[model samples]
Target: MSKWSGVLPRMAITQRSTLLLFALAWLGVCSSFTVIKDGASSLYFCKELDCPKFEEKYNSTAYQIRMYETSKWVSTTITGLDYQAATEEAFMKLFEYIEGENDQHVKIPMTVPVINRIQPGLGPVCASNFTVSFFVPFKFQSNTPKPTKKELFINTLGQEKVYVRVYHGFTNQTNFPKEAADLGDVLNSTQTYDKSYYYTAGYDSPFVSHDRHNEIWFIATDK
Candidate 1:
């Protein structure tokens, strides 16, 4: 299970209310993907404050899998499932694992981008998304410093054990575009990364510390 799924209830309602306001006011919140009632392969969301009800196709096998996974429900029958079936099973297993999510391991943030929707035409064409990952030991305190790059691992076993050092910072102030471009140039020049449509989200590190995380994640997608 992705860490972001676990933080909602623990969050102060004030923050949630604020985010709700942001979503309704700024058109900035990422839409929640939900199942349909007796429908086919599809997902939908309520984009307005007056959204009457969460409507979906309940009979969709895909929707079942989506619910089992996103709602953190799982079953052993999910094993050996392929394609859509496999997705549901995987979500079930992950959801169960996330039930025991501890603060020490899960570091969900206030906002999470699905990645595939934000920056399209980058995923599948090259890498799924150019996510430049690195690690900062807990000793870094609150001071940001030059980060060292690390290889990211796939969740082939479905165990996401990333120990990210978090930080806090304001965006749109630094030369983010230049930094991203520079990192892209380096990654492209070295071929350390599979491709360059994405970038390293390491800029806020030197400003924020390892103890606090204001992760700068870039979204890559295939439209």
Candidate 2:
């Protein structure tokens, strides 16, 4: 046997060990502090993809309180008499922006909870205002690309507390209002939140027909 044969095998083993250690370290750095196998956010139905990071401040059978960090989102408004139709139109507009219809012409990864702020009309015959928004992926939050469409723009939501009520199955015009009303009923009498406008959040796609998750968010007031 050559004198250097043993040294060669030892060197190969050392190289493998260093590579393994480096990989493990890389993973540790990539994983956020709030993420874990069974963390609060993981169990809160943000399992499939990136989502706005939040700290669960309170929980109960009726509803939960989450303090969400300030984040930016791409949003567009649609006004119509029917909630379903307006929301559909708004979704496609935002979808196009994410599908490379922006100045950068870059495709951004979709995120969870397609949230819509609904400002109910004053009268039954009036059109309601629907603002559909998609969370900007964390990587692009700092410098979001400008949308090609004039109506679409990026908006920043400041750090705020929200009362969230989780629901299952599909959300539509008929069901979301009912769900929001139910949530309002369950809230404590002393709880202060915005009643004029509420957010409907969908965490799954229409194609995902089962085990879907949705939510109604009432912005908690400082008072």
Instruction: Name the candidate that leads on TM-score.
Output: 2
Q: Over 4 Å off in model 2, which ranges?
A: 1-44
lDDT for each residue of candidate 2 in 1-223, tens digit (9 for 90 to 100) = 9999999999999867755554443243234222333212455577646688888888987798999999999999898888766766787678778778999998776667789999999998998899999888777888899999999999899898999998889887789999899889988887889889999998765555789989999999953
Best by lDDT, which number?
2
Superposed model 1: Cα runs more than 4 Å off: 1-119, 122-154, 157-168, 171-178, 186-188, 196-223
**For model 2, what is the error of residue 6's alpha carbon versus the real structure, in angstroms, after optimal superposition?**
87
Q: Residue 157 in model 1: shift from native, Å?
A: 8.5
lDDT of 1 by residue, 1-223 (tens): 8786667656767566654543342232123212223221222211111111122222221111001111111112222312223322232333222233322343211111111101223333432222222221122112223212122122111211111112234323244344344434432232332232332222221223344323222221210
Clashes per candidate, residues 3 or more apart or on different chains? 17, 0
TM-score computed on alpha carbons, candidate 1: 0.22
Q: What is the Cα-based lDDT of residue 26 in candidate 2?
A: 29
Report each candidate's C-alpha RMSD, comma-separated, in the order given. 22.3, 17.9
